[model samples]
Target chain A: MSCLETIQSYSLRSIGIGERLLPRSDFTLCEQVVLIGSGMIWNVYFGLMALTTGFFLATAIALGKGSANPWLRKPAEWFIFLFRGSPLFIQFFFAYFLFLNLKGAYPFFDPFTAAWLGALIVLFLNTGAYSAQIFYGALQSIPKGEVEAADAYGLSGWSRFRRIVWPTMLRLAWPAYTNEAIFLFHATTLVYFSGFPAWQQRGDALYYASYFADKTFNPFVPYPILAGYFILLTLVIIGLFGLVNRRLNRHLPANARSKMKLRLNLIR
Target chain B: MFSYCSDPDTLERLWWLSCYLTTGVHFSFYLSFLKVIGILAVTAPVALAFGFAGAMSARSQILPVSWLGKAYIAIVRGVPDIAFFLFFVIALDQGFEWLRHQALCPDWTDPIRQGNDFLVCPQAKLPLGTAPQAVHQAYAFALAVMTFALVFGAFVANVIFGAMRAVPKAQLETAEAYGMSPRQTFWRILVPQMWVYALPGLSNLWQVLIKATPLLFLLGIEDVVYWARELGGTKTARFTAYPHGDWRMWYFLALLVFYLFMTWGSEKVLSRIMARLTRGQATTGGEAQRKGAPA
Candidate 1:
């Protein structure tokens, strides 16, 4: 089939549309590209929703970890440690079983077994924990003078944080936050592998790529195609984060603001 | 297991669990914790060598050699590492087999790539397809170790490369003024100082390496996650001596605590090492140490 015909047939294939069965024999480059590209839709969905939702929770948890009260501080500290310390692969497995038991106990939790909601929750918590640590570090490093100035001007708790602290902390945290977003997006590839069945072969890019590899016994084509898609996605993330970074740091004297570059070191 | 544990179905809760925990597979499950530690112990030094080579080459005066080093650092790190793990295990296995195919089957004219089958002479099969179980496990493990090393070495190279640059340019210049060769300067001046700068990144990388050990399950090693699933799944009475309901949550919880203890202990040990390394250096930690030296 022509590339256009193939796209039409498999554009929504990851979500289980337009085709019931995947290509089984005589695999084409076009088919691999289309199906894998189609699977990227799920990656985008998981990353986007989890990142957006996780952002607020991350901020709250960061604040909690920084708080003076041990009641607030200890739980937040443990939450971050529990998620950050363990492998996210095991987190998915652990969460699946927990949800399965919960579903058995309550009929309302039946939807929790499906990958879409259940897996999204895991990614959300995982990213939230990681980003929280970055934010906590950033928050701690906020200059003493800034908070002192706000306090001297009589800016109290919430407003002091809102006005004097939050923006600066974000500015400091932006580079690492950008790294976290890129990692989280890349991490979406793991959900399918982590006990969360794709349900009718509806999986992310690596899933489809591996499917083709299993069928054709040729690792060369499909995996590289998947990597190409990821490279594009990674670039898009960097570009978007870079743009926001520039805008956020625009007011800082050029030398004072940190420049965001793509750094893949030590994502956990 | 006590005498009362002989009939587990008839036994009460405490006795039933005591007997169940002593099963033969549970012993294997406990040993797998050491396997995770084994990977960390072996991979750290091997990956360090790979990183040192990568960083050294990237710093080389020769352009192509430098580019090779830079590309190695970039490509493995640019993508999610798990993808590399998935790709290389199959690719490396196939590559070894293909080489053996060429070497062992010179008179054979049949194509190795026949449709979907990677057909090769029987001798070309890795582990000879007739090797014992231990050899098969060892081969799979060797593949896992290589994949872990290659992926992590790139990250380490990035850290080392930055650390090398962070060394004062004046220090290298002094060595040059003293008529030291570039190689001598690197060995004496740059190599000694890079660790002080590299420690923070390496410590962080070490934590990441710890968390990443569970991905061994993905590489097809029957690591902790595999054992958890296998042992925690519901067991019918007919299947074995002990039958139980699904218990994966508890198994994974134990795994979670094990990792947390590891990371917590790692933090303590790394901090002590950092303090020792920071002595008489130029970084903040060293500055503080020098200032507080009277104690």
Candidate 2:
């Protein structure tokens, strides 16, 4: 097949759009690229869904962790510890089996056995725990002067948090959180490889890449393509987070403003 | 195994449980945990050495060497490390075999890349085609360790590079003033002081390294995850002792608790080490110590 024809056929192959059968032999460069690029749709979906939903839970968790009441604090602390302390690979396995058991009991959980929902849930909780810790540190280090200044303006409770505490926490946490976001996206590649089976070969980018590698007995080509796709994805994440970082730090002087630096804050 | 374990069907309930847990496969499962620890023990220092060399090269005055180091660090940061793990094991195996083929069969002219095959000479095969199972396992384990070292080394390099920069410039200048050569300043002054700055990142990397141990299964090693799935799968009465239905979840739960304790214990130990390292340093940790503030 021509390169264009190959693209048309396998472009959405990951989501079961065009192709039913994968290429068996004589794997062309174009076919490998198209199929692997097609699989990126799942990666994007997992990362976007988990990161968006995880953001809200992370905020709650951060606040809960900082709350003075033990009723609130203890559970939040343990939640972070449970998710953060264990390897995410094991979490995927455990969660899959848990969901499978739940499916046995309730018909409503039937869909959770598939990679889409089950793996997404694991990613969501994992990122939530990690980012919550980052946010908690930011919340703690929120300059006391900012809270005092807000108190002077009669800002109290929710408004006080909305006005003074939240923005500063985000501002302080944005850099580390960006790192978390990138890693979460990276972590999404683990979904298909984990316990949750990818229904009908509709797996993620790494999945397709590995498929090509296995078929051709060549690692150099397909793995690099996968890496190239991820590097692009990482850049996109940095660009998006950089925009938010700017908005959060907009009021500060140009020189005094915190710049987003992409560093490895190595959490699994 | 207990003497009563001979006939599992005739055993009491508690005895059945005890015998079940003590099966030979279970012992292998237990040994897999040690295998993980062994990998960590071996990989840590080797990766640190790789990282130190990488950091030094990145900070080198020579342009090409610095770029090479920077590229190594940057690539790992962007790519999912599982990709590297998957890629390197196969790639390295083929790479070694290819080199061996080239040396051992110089007169051979057929292309190695023939459609779906990597046709290296038989003599050049990793562990050789005739090698024993033990040799093959050891070869695979060595490759896994090398892959882990290469990937984690880049991460450590990034940490060490930043830590080197974070060490106060004035201290280096003072070393220079004391008639110390540039190499002396780097070895005697910079390397010694950089550890305190590097400690936080290194500790974080250690936790990451721990979490990453499960990926050893992906490398085809019969690690804990492998044994868990094997032992926990459904077994009918036709099979040997234990007849259980899908106990994989519990096995994974046990593994999860194992990792949780491992990481938590590491946290406690790392914090103590951090305290010891920061005792008299000039950083905020040291300042807090001077003020008798609790960490």
lDDT of 1 by residue, B1-295 (tens): 4677777788778878888888789989999999999999999898898998999899889999999999999888767767788888889999999999889998888998898888889999997888999999999999999989988899899899999999999999999999999889999999999898999999989999998999999899989988999999998888887877889888988888898899999999999999999999988889999998896
**DockQ top scorer:** 2
Rate residue A37 of model 1 by lDDT: 96
Q: Which residue runs of candidate 2 sit more than 4 Å off their true CA positions?
A: A265-267, B291-295
Question: B1-295 in candidate 2: lDDT tens per residue?
Answer: 9898988988888999999999999999999999999999999999999999999999999999999999989878778889999999999999999999999999888999998998987888889889999999999999999999999999999999999999999999999999999999999999989999999999989999999999999999999999999998889989767887888999999999999999999999999999999988999889989899654
- Among the numbered candidates, top TM-score falls to 2
Q: Global lDDT of each model?
A: 0.90, 0.93
For residues A99-138, could you state the per-residue lDDT of candidate 1 as single tens digits?
9989999988898878899999999999999999999999
Clashing pairs in 1: none
DockQ of 1: 0.69
lDDT of 2 by residue, A1-268 (tens): 9999999889999999997999998889999989999999999999999999999999999999999999999999999999999999999999999898888889999999999899999999999999999999999999899999999999999999988999999999999999999999889889888888878899899999998888888999999999999889988999999999999999999998887877854438
